[model samples]
Target: MTELARAAAADPAAATSPEPVPTTPDGVPRGQPVLDRLVALLDLERIEENIFRGVSPAESPVRVFGGQVAGQALVAAGRTVPEDRHVHSLHAYFIRPGDPRVPIVYEVDRIRDGRSFTTRRVVAIQHGKAIFSLSASFQLREHGLDHADAMPEVPDPESLPSFADRVSEYGARLGDMAKLPRPIDLRYVTEPAFLSRESGPRDARHQVWMRADGSLPDNDLLHVCVLAYASDMTLLDAVLVRHGVYWGLDRVIGASLDHAMWFHRPFRADEWVLYDCASPSASGGRGLATGRFFDRDGTLIATVVQEGLLRIAS
Candidate 1:
């Protein structure tokens, strides 16, 4: 038997008959079609007791986006866990570029289960090769000492131009990209990386307001997964903006190497959260970025750190 099948066979909890699952979670809001696709993306299919399958959007880019895999892997891990337990942290590595044309299979291994904490490791595979892996820890509700960094002052998200409005100046230059589905609403507190490239080099820090485009079902894991999907949307930009470089505009090709996140305090992904991102250092063709999510009331919600491989041409 396969190692995963043996593991499932060995566990009484997993040996029981499996239940039916839907491609997308129930009560998926439909008013926002793009967001609907995103919601459907996270709802993985239960391939077996310990394996799940996910698909990329039909309009996926050349390669699968890192965030999509991370979020889907987390959803796979979360599915093997209890609803009462909430994921507190996750660490992931991108081993290889994912192929958007095929299905990605997620294999979940129950690492540990304690009274207070549960952990699972997920491997995303395609063509019988591991493309990505993630380990996540879940914790039951508990009271403990608490402290966090104060949030930075930023203009209201409503005051800032919507992503489309802000990028309208690029017009024909952005072309098809401008018409793409945006499941997450973005509001930059300052000039976005590309716009700043035009303005000239400046600081290493920038902030943006982020949230799901529409209402989400009342599920903690789904919310966290959505935020995970959104995290990669502009994290690499933090690195590029530091040197005033852009993707197509500059001779630069970069990919996310690893991603880590720690969730703190309960928050809704549908509600606006200020994402403060900055790159601390760049060397050896790699750049590292750190980000913190804060709610409208300035309460810290989550923290993220990512490193990417950036090959820049002189």
Candidate 2:
């Protein structure tokens, strides 16, 4: 077994458990448990060498979430490379909407394997056509000039109300918000961008504390992939905040155009990290946003940038 696999085996949380009903801080039962389902979502089924199949959990029926494909494609690429080489960067583009009713097939291309760095390209296919494509770079451990921006001052995660609590505050207008699968527990430090029907005087930035709802194995790849999955949850919300448009509240339509991420340090998905996000610009029906993920002690773990198509119906 690989050293990383051994580490995962050592983690007690790797053991399977019965699924539980999801609930909020106020004990309102909502949907099925999420951690196990998330694990299943990431566990791609290897069909053949360099090819893998992944399925989405039964959550939103409209379309497969973009993050799921990105994470699974990373997993497919990681399987082809050695465990010692960790992923440092990835760039991906969504070509078409994924059909959640069907499984997605990922094909990994062995682009290059160098002594110091490795490169991989992954294509996600459904309906015999490419739905998404990604290129990732991996590197061996090496020390470099260490510099990062300081984590911004914000209320501790524990001090804020859970996302479940915030959603419950919306009451019936948002429907059964708790019924949605929430694998990552998010605590907003400010009023959620979707709360108001009109744009306020607030800036086009947001901060939230998030972590996997349950413990995960010690596998480094899994942890990174999980973070990739969670990163997409609210990054684009920064753009919506600027226009005072809530996805469900207004006649707004949006889809991620592309995503890019850089891993600066090793971090666990089960631990609290603050995600600070802002939209620098929006024009010609597209909006660009950037974010920084910081650990509880103010250590920068990762940075993300994404551009998405945003249009509000007249």
| Best candidate, TM-score | 2
Error of 1 at 235 (Å): 1.2
Which stretches of model 1 miss by more than 4 angstroms?
1-31
Each candidate's TM vs. the true structure?
0.89, 0.93
lDDT of each: 0.85, 0.85
Q: In model 2, where do residues sit more than 4 Å from their true spots?
A: 1-9, 18-22, 25-33, 176-178, 198-201
Structure candidate 2, residue pairs in collision: none
In candidate 2, clashing pairs total: 0
Candidate 1 lDDT by residue in tens digits, 228-282: 9999988878888878888777788899999999999899998999999999999
Per-residue CA lDDT of candidate 2, range 1-314, in tens? 53334554576565345456657765654322466567667778888988989898766557888988999999999988888999999999999999999999999999999999999999999999999999999999999899999999999998998787787766566654445667888999856876744446367887889998877877889899989999998998888877778776778888999999999999998899999999999999999999999999999999999999898889
Look at candidate 2 and tell me the lDDT of residue 2. 36
